[model samples]
Target chain A: DQQVKQNSPSLSVQEGRISILNCDYTNSMFDYFLWYKKYPAEGPTFLISISSIKDKNEDGRFTVFLNKSAKHLSLHIVPSQPGDSAVYFCAASASRSNTGKLIFGQGTTLQVKP
Target chain B: DTAVSQTPKYLVTQMGNDKSIKCEQNLGHDTMYWYKQDSKKFLKIMFSYNNKELIINETVPNRFSPKSPDKAHLNLHINSLELGDSAVYFCASSLTIGTSGAYEQYFGPGTRLTVT
Candidate 1:
């Protein structure tokens, strides 16, 4: 079963506009969530993350929002740039397990038009 | 210098063949992992090693075996590969498995394996 789900297969947005990507999880035990960006032929790289205790975390132009009650999380990029185009994956890990294993979503490909 | 590197970036073989993929990390991390991304673009963890010891083994098949000779190297050997084995495999490293939210993993350029 897919514990993490990124329902949107793809997304398109104009440059300098806001881009929002959504993710949902079925496993309530997951306490930490992270976002990774991957390009073609390259491995995924860490982007941002948020703890279940916090509602939001921001770094520069990227922000992550987590709603524990809804079991949903989102990544927001303000003034999106063409360079931001890539596949975005949402991952979660239950710290209690202490295995540091991550369950990843199906990934959403984001395209920014310049 | 590359943080995590995997040899044989591309592998093509027939079914029932055996192949090995080698991975190395120069980041001096104590933990290593293997992940597979299938045609549907779903990334899943297969195994994880910490300091050359097996820590996490997912529900992967017995045909897939992971060996860690040292903390910096983890290798995967697949026997009797099937059509379903065609996918991109990624090697990753982390400093340590922690309960803190600061844990982050660095990944290598994936190795794409095609089974005929």
Candidate 2:
């Protein structure tokens, strides 16, 4: 079973616009969530992360919001740039004691149209 | 510098053949992991190692095995490869073991394995 799910298969947004990507989880025990951006023929790179204790985390143009009760998380990029075009993945884990294993969702291809 | 690096960017072999994929991380992180991205583009965990010790081995096939000689290196070996086993394998490293759980994973470019 897929513990992490990204319902949107693809998202397109214009440059200078806000891009929002949503993800959901079936495992309530997951206390940590992360987002990774990937380019074709390249490995995924870390973007942003949030702990269960915090509802939101932001760094520069990227922001992540989590709702533990809903088992959901969303990533927002303000004034999205063409460089942001790539596949995005949402991952989660319960705790360190659970073996530091990350479960990833099916990626969502994002295209930042200029 | 490449924090996580895997050798043989591409591998193509016949079924029933055995092969291995090597991985190394220079990030000085204590933890390393292996993930497989299948034809459908879903990334799945195959194994994880911390400080040269095996930690997590997912529900992967017995034909698959992971070896870590040191904290900076983790390798994957597959015996009797199958068509279903063909996929892009990624190596990643992070600072925490169970410390931050699954906080951050820095990945390599990925090793694309194809079984004929």
Summarize candidate 1's per-residue lDDT along A1-114 as a digit string, tens digits.
Answer: 889999999999999999999999999999999999999999999999888889999999999999999999999999999999999999998989988899999999999999
Residue A35 error, candidate 2, Å: 0.3
lDDT of 2 at A61: 97
Tens digit of per-residue lDDT, candidate 2, span B15-72: 9999999999998887889999999999998899888888888899999999999999
Off by over 4 Å in 1: B99-102
TM-score for candidate 2, residues paired by index: 0.96
Model 2 segments more than 4 A misplaced:
B100-102
Where does the lowest 10-residue lDDT sum fall in candidate 2 chain B? Answer: B95-104
Please report, in order, the local distance difference test score of every candidate based on alpha carbons: 0.95, 0.91
**Tens digit of lDDT per residue, candidate 2, span A1-114?**
889999999999999999999999999888888999999999999999999999999999999999888889999999899999999999998784567778899989999999
> Please, what are the lDDT tens digits per residue for candidate 1 over residues B1-116?
99999999999999999999999999979899999999998999999999999999999999999999999999999999999999999999988887344358889999999999
Per-model TM values vs. the true structure: 0.98, 0.96
